[model samples]
Target: MSTYGSRGDVEPMAALAVTLQELGVEAVVCAPPEDEFRALLERAGVEMVAAGMAVKELIAEAKANPHITLPERARKVTSRQYEAVLEVAQKADVIIGSGLMPAAAGARTVADQLGLPFHLVAFQPVTMPSPYQPPVAYPGRPLPPDVTDNRELWKHDAESMNVIFGAAVNDHRVSVGLPPVPSIRAYVLNKRPWLAVDPVLSPWRPSDLLDVLQTGAWILPDTRPLPAELEAFLEADQEPVYVGFGSMAMGNAPAEVARAAVEAARKQGRRLVMAKGWAGLEAIDEADDCFVVGDVNQQKLFPRVAAVVHHGGAGTTTAAARAGTPQVIVPQVVDQPHFARRVAELGIGVAHEGSVPTSESLAEALNRALGMTRRAQEMAGQIKTDGTLVAARELGVA
Candidate 1:
């Protein structure tokens, strides 16, 4: 298994790895060489092979080098994957690729070279092209305003993918003595790519473009106990609103976002449990009602919260749903908006209009979310928790 991105990307792969191990299959994961990722796989008792630069380093480099185009950066990252994943994949019976397209492209090429069966896995349904939904627009490339048809949008999406990764991928493929692929999108997605998402949360519509395997969201059972401080805080409060943007940079003003969340919770007459994630969000003041936590067990904490205010990552959204907690989804980028829309469609949460939210916006969303508590609880029982098990069985490793 190979993946690259934030905790959201790495965590699910780790979960699947753990399940595979239990089924008597020795699993090794190739991912970004970040301390947190290493620790996660270590805890799961799975071997980890560092795939490329750490996610932070990659993001920082992209920011620092403004002259470098997205395509060029993607080329560099994909090239690095060849160096890292090739050796590990040589010993594997099959190759599974996930995370960013460029990284997956590199791993796929290695699989091609080794004559291994390669499978691409998407965490959300939006990543896969379909007539039911349009593809996500590229960073600087927006879809034409006049184009309302999903098929046209997907066609443009394919063109954009080719523009960004076609040369980068084909160049490496040529270097490794493989034939150049005509469509980078098709090559990466393959004929039957797996969708690792909870069907209740994000359903995959059958498409003529590809045969998608919809597995329930890969969830590792988190046994780590919540910190005593957080436990006491939860005990003392009347179901405080839990606010956290897992792995999202939270834009240029993380502190402002944190303050807005705190103020919003206060307006609702509720306590706040803030997670200081990768953006390093901090409390504005040492208020007793606002408790700040770091790297705590969200699985154990979400059930006790009034509502979850989050960035709408696939994993976090699923966790909140499984906990039977209502949500306010303030999406950031990529598949986040899709998850936000799903939450609202399910009547389990409110999707904030934009990425950045002021106190008023957050409070309003929070109010709506709190009102949907009954619906959220009703949906909780429907979410499947056996995604990893199902995926392992599908692999026929046991």
Candidate 2:
């Protein structure tokens, strides 16, 4: 299957592939060739291939090739990525994939040509129209008070995506020798939709259009031992609060965030573990109790921490949930803010209002999260089931 993005995007696919293997089907994840999560996939013994462009390079290409609109580049990228996975999937009996522009662009059309089953996957309710909540991708800010509880507006979320991206999506169809889809609904509704998230997070809301089967989160846990230094830190007298924003570049913002995190740590009188993410947050100075390190497995670390602080990516959110730790959600992009909202709604964490995390805001959220430990722990127990294996059962992989 093809998948891409940072740890949040690719790691889930790796976990699913591992689960398929456990069900007696050989599976490989085609993902961005990044070492952070790739190392975890490797440790899990799941096969990962470089598919499409790397996240860092994709960003660079967008900046360097500004003449090409992002949507257009997305189309071109997906077109280029079409055959790489199809070449592998067509050989197999079934095709399952998610993540990134290219994989979503052409996988289904190619699978349709071969008359093979293409199981579509989703990490969140961002795409699906739901009665329970607004579309995670809804463009408008602060809902008008009247539409607050109305689930009908949520359906338009998918419609808006189709309206914006329909032509680009059809370009993929024409290239793949498939008929153009009339709408986003036509494009996506043809497949058996598999939602690879915890049912607790994406519980089935009433909907005629979305017959989504919720599998508990597809968690391919990292199996490696933590670095000796990190392990020692965990064993220390004071439990540290964790901080890391995966892959979201913080530009000139890191120093402030670092300062905030340090001050926040000081205010709480707690130790800290700060991950210098993609150079997002650098260590400005040595703090007595804080340890700044590179990407490490959250699966192994969150359990030992007092709380998790990050840019609320699905993987990080799920990891912290499973670890039973409260969270400070400093979301930076799409789907992240949605997860952050869920964190607050479920009483497990705090979701900041905007993108870019400020230290003061993070500290406020962290304090709130610390107070919600009981709720967070309760959620941890509820979402711990393996969604990957459940997905295999649903798709009849066995």
Q: Which numbered prediction scores highest in TM-score against the true structure? A: 1
TM-score of each: 0.98, 0.90
Model 1, residue 227: C-alpha shift (Å): 0.9
Residue-level lDDT tens digits of model 1 in 1-398: 98989999999999999888888887889999999889888887889999889999999998998999999999988988877888787678988899999999998998889999998998988879899888888988889899999999999999999988899999889988999998999999998999999998988878687799898999987888998888898898588999999898887989999989999999999999999998899998978998999887888999999999999999999999999999999999988999999999999999999898999999999999999999999999999998887787788864
> Predicted candidate 2: what Cα RMSD to the true structure?
2.8
lDDT to native, each model = 0.91, 0.74
Report the Cα lDDT for candidate 2. 0.74
For model 1, name the residue pairs that clash: none
Which stretches of candidate 1 lie above 4 Å from their native place?
Answer: none
Best by lDDT, which number? 1
In candidate 2, clashing pairs total 1
Position 124, candidate 1: lDDT: 80
RMSD of each: 1.0, 2.8
RMSD of 1: 1.0
Task: Give a tens-digit lDDT track for model 2, residues 106-169.
Answer: 6666677788777778787666666665655433333355666546565455566565556677
